[model samples]
Target: MTAYVGKRLAQAVLVLWAAYTLSFVLLSALPGDSVHNRIANPEAQISPEEAKVMLAYYGLDRPLAEQYLHALGGVFRGEFGYSLSSGDSVGHLITSALPSTLQLTGLGLVFGVLFAGVVAVLINYGRWRWLRSLVTAVPSLFASVPTFVVGIVALQYLSFRLRLIPSVDDGTVRALIAPAATLGLVVAAPLAQVLATSMRATRRQPFVHVLQAKGAGEGYIFRQDVLRNSSLPVLTLLGLAVGELIAGSVVTESVYARAGIGQLTVSAVNTQDLPVVQGVVLLSTAAYVVVNLVVDLVYPLVDPRILVEGRSRRSARWRTDGQAVESAADLPAGSARRLPAEVAMP
Candidate 1:
């Protein structure tokens, strides 16, 4: 288990490094420097020489390799540099915006899991076959709809027409409803689909039949066996859904006018603020890696078979080594084990 965790951590670091390098390269390739972007205002007119000086001041005139090394070092020290557009510390900007994004992610994940769980239960455990089929199909339909479209529809209907919630920028819990639901519905679709399929397969397994033969009730068997077995896949999907949540947040926050890392990212891109953009990308990559690492660590807890599988592999290796040793011992002291005669060394 320790070795597995160490391996995963190493892989996570490599992934983060790759993401950072790619983001830096792409941002550097973008036309116009921060100075050019800032000097675009006619009232704040600046000459080409002045722009050159500004670039040099910001160390943008350095070689690409030097700049990359400096940026990487800054990241390790939690120094994200200054935002070219706002003149704010990139680290400060990210920290300020991170809480909102975290809240949105948490709410969306909770809502999605609850929605998927309810739908899966109705589809698998309910009596009406037609209704169950309809419930099963809903997730696919929801999955097809883009999160932005959902956010727009929710704003139009739930907030404006129905008056069920406040406007998107109202800065209240009620304002979170539309955007959270938009993201939740998008993520819930795939989760529910996977879970429903897993549940159906679990129900058909021989153990379920054995439970039935033992006179166990349907509810008992479902609660004790089916749900537990089906949960491993669901847990995996939940980890993967973090990416979806992050992607969806960019659109959802834009539509809802929320202050978050998503909004920060968009603004940084529009202004070509390389440092802030790189910071956001790095932060997102870290979040993804950390979430997946947690999922890997928790996997053995969910299914002991994972640990057992590792043990089985080790046991097999040990058995092979023992057999080789015994064969060596059985051979005469001065003789070597026979090798295939196909092409023995000349």
Candidate 2:
């Protein structure tokens, strides 16, 4: 387990480093930067000498290699300098905006999970075959539509026509409904697709048929046998969904005009506020890495086949002979193994 955790941690760190480096390289390659833009603004009237000093202070006057190294070191020390457009510390700008984005993400995830759960359940257990077929098609429809369109349509109908939710953010729960639901729909599409596929596959396994033949109730079999077996892949999907959530937030925040990291990101990028932009990218990359790392660590706990002894399921002998096929090394010495019930359908 420790070794598995260490490996995942290393991979997370590598991903963060790669994302930071790639973003910096790409942003540096851009035609001009915030300093240049600001200097060109006649309204600010920043003199040539002042401009030179500003460039040097921000390390823009240095070679790209030196600047990259300095910025990388600064990130290591939690130093992101200042935002060119706002003239505030980049950290302060992000910190101020972080809470709103976090709230949006939490609410969006909740709504998304609920949507996916309902869809998955209906696909698996709906009374009418046509209803299940219709439910299955919903995910593809969701996946085909862009998130912003959903937000716009929801805004038009829910806020404009029906007045069910406030169109603008007033720092109230009523203000959050449309945007959260839009983001949730985007999240639900892929999650529901994957979950429904897994659940249906699990339904066809031999053990499920065995349970049914033994007169197990449908509700009991579905709850105890089917749900647990199909949950592992969905847990993995949730980790990957963090990326989608962050990406979707940019459009969602813009549509709803919410003050958040997403809005901050949009402003920073538009003005070419490199420091703030890089800070946001780095923060987002770190978040993505951390969530995936946590998921990797949790996988062993959720699925016994993922042996914490660093053995892959492919390596383990899978004996479904009503016996515990897991290694004795994974258990306390001399401990009696408790074999779990085998219930799958063919």
Best by lDDT: 2
Model 1 Cα lDDT, one tens digit per residue, 55-130: 8767788999999998889888888888887778999999999988888888999999999999999999889989
| C-alpha lDDT values of all predictions | 0.85, 0.87
Clashes of each: 0, 11
Per-model C-alpha RMSD: 6.8, 7.2
Best-fitting candidate, measured by TM-score? 1
Model 2 TM-score is: 0.88
Worst 10 residues of 1 by lDDT: 316-325
